[model samples]
Target chain A: MTGYLVRRTGQMVLTLFLIITFTFFLVQAQPGDYASFYVLNPDLPPEVKDQIRAAFGLDKPAWQQYLIHLKNTFTGNLGVSFGNFPRPVLDVLVERVPRTLVLFLTATAVSFYIGFFLGKAMAWRRGGLFEYATTISGALLFTAFTPAFGLMMIWAFAFKLGWFPVGKFLDPLVWRGADVSANYVFGNMLLSAAAFIAFALLVMLCLKRFGRRVPSVAAFPIVLGGALIIVAAWALSGIGGLALDIVKHMVLPVATLTLISFAGTMLLTRNSMLETIREDYVMAARAKGLPDKLVRDRHAARNAMLPIVTSLVYSLIFAIDGSVIIESVFSWPGTGLTLLQAVRSEDLPLVMGAMLFIGMLSLLAHVIVDVLYVYLDPRIRYQ
Target chain B: MTDRHDPLLKVDGLSLSYQTRLGEVQAVRNVSFELARGSALGLVGESGCGKTSIANCLMRLLPDNARLSAGRVLLDGQDILPLAEEDMRLLRWRRISMVFQAAMNVLDPVYRVGRQIIEAIETHGVESTDTAARERVARLFRMVGLDPQLMERYPHEFSGGMRQRAVIAMALSCDPDLMIADEPITALDVIVQDRILRELKAIQQQLDMSIIYISHDIAVVAEVTDVVGVMYAGRLVEMGDTSDVFRAPAHPYTAALMSSFPSVSGERRPLTGLPGEPPNLSDLPQGCPFHPRCAYATDVCRTQYPPQARYGSHWAVCWHPLDATMAVQS
Candidate 1:
């Protein structure tokens, strides 16, 4: 397995290199560079525009410019953003990527758990009314366009009902400066640590109490109890109102992403589970006198989970590409929105920077998935 | 004829049907057999004759669409039909386990072979501690001619025969009272098949448990079974002691089946193939299911279902039962 990981890591590096090479050339292949945007300004003279081009090395041949970009990238110099002149591309990305990551990563995790378990239940009660209802509704959610769905959510929940704010990451009117003081940050960190320790103790308690009675399902309460404790600890801290406001702002966009992806994930899980439930091993498990739940979870769900895991890895890899349309629709200031504006304004530095990060993310995600495969399937020998 | 002293397993008039999109298929019809303790009964038949269905019914392992439409499956003194699904689950594996036909593919590929068996043992609440279960699993592996160390490997890591042995070890883990081996060695090579059969016979003797061995190969069944029943078109056409059934088949279908198999040390008789095919269960012929393929089939055979005819303890479904005196006359 170690050997396999090493080989896969090498392959991932090569893949990322190829992706960077292609993206760099392709973005440059356009008629002009970011300097052309400056040419359109009435106050700028043609000679001044020419100087700006030379200073930025856009006036150099494509090969020379590419080599320069490669050297700068290797030296950790992402260059100044043309869109926001004098600001480094890496600095701009560092500010925006985490927000996008938090939003999409949380949404993906929430939707996966919901969809996967719901799909398993649907398959178990196959041909029943519950199955039909979930299948039909899940299909509708899966097939709906993302932008349209996001808009509908915004219209219904935000605009018409006024249940949520129309849009933006925060309500600036309420908090004035919503960023918390460093003292609060330190306090929250301590609380978070306390919550983590408490959660671990809770799980041990649950295991001691219920593990022997229900050996197959003892871990479930630990996860559930742990989540409750962490959330409770956060809410009980002095900054609960601020956290609540952020969660409130997150509702619409997160819901839209969750609903849309939940359908597809659930459907995929259901179909794969249906196929797995029919395998001869399932029958063997059943014949072993295992209860219905254990048979489904231990024997059937583990096998059905393979395809779902693959899709999950691919989704994570592409997540950095941003949910561009959803971000635009919600007016969420994430990297996806940044990528769109950068491309439209022909900010070559920012575009290349974002693309590089995305390419790296994809390669890293692939390696992580390969590593996880060894744990999920023992038959997968590294050699 | 059931009493307090009835056989360990008595399947009386067992019938099952599957409801598909097309229609209902009567997979097993009025199939009855008794298995005493410490004996093996082989149900021999071609494909689609409901051999596997019967095995499934015994374990209550049928799919959602398939139902045990009629009859009672008596395990010891308890009728399994009326048992709650939850209760039936307890009966399965612990009381009556099954080795599926695709034995090689019947283990979870993601888990170690030993872990899979341990899962069964643990699920059935056989052992309180993991170490005790591990020790039992190792013993089972050795009993089935497998190395205890090989238990750490996944299903895909083992060869076909080894996988079958693992499956057998799993079935025996709980020390079930009845083991239903559904064509356990059909997919294996000749040498592996012989070895597995020998291992199975040894296990049977050592464990002293009844087995319902379902297979298509008469020769394979003869080597392992004390009693044999020949099925045609979902009906048991002939049944008796294995030796009597093989030496003197009362039913023409059984006789034809016995004649088709080549003998290693006997007169070289040209093999006679049974003509035509088994009738479809959804739309069976009006009379005897085997009439079209039976050379001895008469007008009465084609017009109505044959009554049960007896010779000593052996029995067959036939209108014109072969005479015993004719054996000397011939």
Candidate 2:
């Protein structure tokens, strides 16, 4: 475990370095710098504009400016915004990072857990009614209008029916103070943690209990109830309220993203399972007087999961890059949205910061997947 | 009348066919045999002669397209063909288990070998406690001549022979009454094959389990099995005690098969290879399927199929049986 952690941390540092290098060069290659934005503002005196440019070291060579940016980034100084906000780029990111993490993490957890078991079910009952329905729905929902699909859902639930708030981070009333009472804070934290644990446990138990059996009458109702309860509890809490609002705002985007992602994952898992099931060892497992479900899960599914794991890591990296469109559609303040704003305003520091963060995240995802590949499959190992 | 001393498995007039996009392919036709309890019966044939197909049908492991056109497979006294999928699941691995070819590669690489066995046991409602399951797994490993300590290792950690042994241990986990070993030693080296066969024989003696062993090697079958069946064109051409079939093969195909292998005793004879490939099931020649390849083909042999004739305990499905006169002349 210690060795794994050490390797992962080393890889993470290398990834960050690459991200910083790429961001530095890419930002320098852009047409204009922070000085160009200031030059466009006619109200400012020419001397004052030159003084402002000099203050930020914009007049220096691009290479020198890049070194200064790197030093400032390391020392917790992201420099000022170009849109006259007078705030550091880091502060803007800090305020929005939590919101994005909450929304994305929740969606990821929900989608992964749900999609995995559903895919398993579809594979197990390849020709049955439930499997047929899921395959068709999954293909249709994901293949058609991925991004617009999310908007369609938002229109139906929030705009058409007024079932939930349409778009925003939160109500802002609940989390107004950073240093709230310990009891309230702890209570909220415990509730959120407990909820997460419960949902995870429920998903695991469902997968375990009904893994082999055909789709029972109770399957759909039980899953629907569980999803409803989770959504309700999440929308009711302070942090959850913020998360729920983001989710509601994200309903269309996530749905669109999940459709395409689900298609890829489901196709991969189904093919792997099908191939693994035909292996001679599978017959050996069946010959052991083991039940069909046990043979499928413990023998077939476990082996098939190796490829799925790799695909998931690649998907995560792709997701970070793909979030730009979703961010624009929802108007949710995130790195993707902030980067776009920086590009338009010619804020070189902010653009580099956002790009570097995304690039690092992608690299980190890749490293994590590579390390896990070795552990999950004994065939792989570092020399 | 059901003989109390009869074999544990009896497959009578079994005919199996598979439907493909082209047409129906008759893979196994009118095959009949019995496996005495605690004894091994070897099914030997070339690749397309339906050895594996027969095994699959006996285990009811055929794909969705295959159909058992005729005959009955009696496990003890129960018919296996009409059994429900769930009922088959119950009987499989418990009453009748299989050790398939290339089975070493079948272990779940993600899990430890011990946990996999434990999962198998728990799935069948064997051991409720982890301790009990571990103890059972250890006992199984010991029975297969493997160290119990190695159970914690992953499948990839074990050598080929060791992995096959682990698979054997799993097959024996439930103390199955009948174990179908389908070319279990085919993929191993000659040395490892000898070792695994020896271990299997010992385990059979200890447990008194009947095994339906399938192989293409006539010599290997002679060493391990009491009775042997030689198949040709999806049909059993000859079947009898191993000594009887090897010493005096009635069916020409069986005679050809025996001569194909060089005997260790240096009693060498010119091998008479079968002419032409095995019949294509979708478009088989009329009448006797083997007549086209048989040297003693006549008008009767080409016009009508031969019925199985019993001579003592041995049976042969040939119009012109290789009696002493024919054998000497050939």
Candidate 3:
């Protein structure tokens, strides 16, 4: 295990180095740098243009600048953003990341929960109205154009119904009274959600270790408690208004992402579950005299989860890559949106940072998926 | 003597069919038999000959497409055919459990072997406590010649024979009155098959339980079963005491099947194959389903379905009996 971890860490570092070098050179090779804004200005004199170019490091040779970039990135100095000057690239990315995390991670979690649940239902007692309806609708939704859907969602929910904000991450009006930043609240929400998940897993671990079932009813109180705890913590910290504002702003995009992505997981789960139910073990489980519920959940659905879990982990890692279209459509300030802006304005520092982050996360996701595979599926454990 | 008043199980006129795309596949037709309290019965036939269908029907574990056209499965005089799913669930594993075909795949690979068996035990509420249920599983593992410590291992970790034994241990978890072992050891090697059959025979005697061992191999079943029923193309062609049927072998199909196998202890003889395939259930011949394959098939065999004809204590559904004195009386 130690060897595996060490090997994966080395691979991740190498891959990130390649990503940093590749994106850095690609953005550097663009026709002009960020200082071209000043050079193109008729009002600016040649000497002033040269000063601006030097300040932005565009006056140096491409190879010379590449060396500085490699050293800074390696030393964790992502450098200052030319577009959002005076602020380091790391600070800007850190601010935008939690918002993207809060949005896409929530969507992924919600979609998976719905998908796995409904997919199991569809496969267990197939040919039902519920199964057909969901399958038909899920397939259509899965293939639907995300941009058009996101726009329709904004039009219907925001423009027509006057529900939720039209765009952006937070309402300046609410934040005027509250001193807390929206990013701080989004960060806290992610932490609290993570805590609740850890707690739920701990509860399940205890129950499973004892060979006791985690009764369905028992989950309700724990979930209710987790919600209450999160709410109380946010309210007591006096940033409930700020958190609510961010949530309100997130509604349209999150809803759109969830609905579209829900179909993918649902259909994948349904197909995988269909195959799993036909496995001889499922028949053996039934012959074991397990009631319909236990047989479906324990024997069939759990086995069906292998492929879905793999798909989910890879998708979640790409969530760090962020959705350019989703973020742009909503005008949400996230890594994807910022990456787009940086690329357009030739902000090499910011774009390289985003690419390196995604590359590192992608490798980490592979490691995580492999570890989970060994844990969830014993057949692969030996191999 | 068998208990006429209350046999362990009485499957009366049990017929089952599946509604497939090709129309109704009559998998099992009017198959009836009674199992005594402490004896093992073996149902042997060629593949796709309704042997498995009978096992599934007895456990009430047929697929969604299957229809139990007619039957009364009486366990302790209680007809279980009309029982609701909820009621049948309670009856299953507590009354009639099954170790399915290819016992290697019977265990879910994700769960530990002991947990899967414990699930069977806990489902029936057989044990008072979880620890007791686990202990029962440990005892069962030991009973089936598996180490109790190995119970925590997954199905993939165990060898093919070990998996079969684990499945056997699981079937015995609730100690049902009758255990239907459908091709239980067919997937294992010859050496493991002999060991498992021996263990199974010992377990049946030690627990005083009835078992219906279903197999296509007549030789394997003959060794472990007290009574043997031979089926062909969805019908029970012959049934009698194992020794009686093995020795006399009245039906031509039975005689062919017997000769198909090389007997280990008997005098040396060349093995013979029963030519032609078992007729498709949906598109069977006009008369006796096995007549096309039977060497002694005649005009009477082709014109009418044969009913059960007795020859002393043994009964066979055949137009002609091999024994010279047995007249064709149904």
DockQ of the candidate models in sequence: 0.81, 0.63, 0.83
Question: Which ranges in model 2 have alpha carbons more than 4 Å from their true place?
Answer: A1-14, A127-147, A171-253, B1-4, B126-128, B270-272, B324-330
Q: Could you give the CAPRI-style class of model 2?
A: medium
Name the candidate that leads on DockQ: 3
Residue pairs with colliding backbones in model 3 are none
lDDT of 1 by residue, B1-330 (tens): 455356999899998999998899999999998999889999998889999889888888778799887899888878998999999998888999888898877999988899999988988889988889999999999999999999998888899999999999999999999999999999999999999999899999999988889998888888899999999888999898998888888888888877778876778999987678777889888778888887777888888998777665678887766655423211
Regions of model 1 farther than 4 Å from truth: A1-7, A45-47, A177-238, B1-5, B326-330
lDDT for A374 in candidate 3 is 93
Native contacts matched by each model = 0.92, 0.74, 0.85
TM-score for predicted model 2 compared with the true structure: 0.87
Q: lDDT of all the models against the reference?
A: 0.83, 0.76, 0.86
Q: By lDDT, who's the top model here?
A: 3
Report the TM-score of the second chain of model 3 against its true counterpart. Answer: 0.96
| Residue-wise C-alpha lDDT for candidate 3, range A1-383, written one tens digit per residue | 67767877787888888888789888978888887867668998999888878887888999999999899889989999888898899899888866777788888889899988988888877786898899899988887887898899989999999988999988888788666666667888788878988888876676667637456557668778877987898888877778888889988888988898887888888899999998999988887778888899988999999999999986787555547889999999988899999999988888887777667667777877888899889888432
> Residue B121, candidate 1: how far off, in angstroms?
1.3
Ranking by DockQ: 3, 1, 2
Worst 10 residues of 3 chain A by lDDT: A208-217
